[model samples]
Target: MLIFLSLYFLNDIFAFSGSQDLCGYCFDTLVNSFDKRNSILSPSFKNEQHPIFVTWKKKGQLRGCIGTFSPLPLHSGLQEYALISAKRDDRFRPISVSEVPDLDVTVSIMHSFEQASRWDDWKVGVHGIRVSLNDGTSIYSATYLPEVMSELGWNQEQAIESCLQKGGYRGKLNDRIKAQVQVTRYQTSISKMDYQEYIQWRKAKLTSIRGDL
Candidate 1:
């Protein structure tokens, strides 16, 4: 399970209203990092281990996206990857503190991984596919999140072919190469929040805490 970054913007058709708290926690972590603070306001959710991804967008464009397939403790994992994806995704420059106010954050929790029967076995919009290709001496691998297919309007075969190319496969896309591809399919529960929403959520949370106190 390797960490990969995607530049694709999530399709508008899919709605991710799962966990604002999760996205809030990610935003908190990033804001703290930018401010040189070590303290994080505890998240309002239970800590559990899950394979997670953190994605950042600026004005609906991809800023950074990265995550791992390994299950990790939610609190620490979110905190870690929140910064990693925002600042370390090599495809784009590191996100600055100034960018924080304009960014949107998304958190994806991946699960139900199954080995596909064939390269084209996975569903287009339902499953995120990871492809591994071995071209005799070298091995290449990459993954696209579930929304990618629908956003790009690709059928199963096209999605697989795109994934092969994404995995750094430079060889021909003949049947032999396609036949040798190993695919693993997984699904994700996603949550998203924009910077303004984060501020509002934080304000409401603080007000609630104060009232309780």
Candidate 2:
């Protein structure tokens, strides 16, 4: 039988309250390139999603931002990739020890990819995005916008332009061969910076609430 089913991720609608492990897991995933999404996901808490976008900010300015598109890669889901993206997106390097004290993190739980051929497909403050061409040879990613580019002093055009430039489109932006743009959306659990004692607290909480780890 051709069995089929519809699946959904409910991490965004209801998040784990009280304990800050999800925030910590997302932060750990952003800070360290270690795959710990599963171990970090608390079954008792009931949210089982990984690789959410982790954006770092200080005051009202952007510090660093990064995450994975798909749930990392099974054993090593978004946990490792997100951290790598934040620290090594090339736009900015990993947060340094000096800058650590003045940063915050936002974890955006991502959705699947969607292609936009019509201009109507675009929207502000919604839709995380990926533009690709040459059969996936070229690609550019942006998860949760307005914030990402706005922080970089970019308008909508500038953001898409940057993507186009980085996307390696041999022709101009208005080239006859239109782009194969893939858009993905995510829900973020943004928390204020809680560096001091956050990790230690998480370690204790995870073990206490859910002994699986």
Best by TM-score: 1
Q: In model 2, which residue pairs have backbone atoms overlapping below 3 Å?
A: 72-77, 72-78
lDDT of 1 at 162: 81
lDDT of 1 at 59: 91
Tens digit of per-residue lDDT, candidate 2, span 1-213: 001100344433244323355456555554443333424533233435444555666555666666654443322444554455557767776666565445555555544334555422555455444554443555543334434654576654455656656655555545333434443333333334455545565667666767643
lDDT of 1 by residue, 1-213 (tens): 322211121221023338798899899998988675534677877666677899999998899999988777788999999999999999999999898889999898876677888887889889999899988898999998997688789998888888888878777767887789999988788898999999998888888988999
Clashing pairs in 1: none
Q: Distance from true position, residue 163, model 2, in Å?
A: 1.8
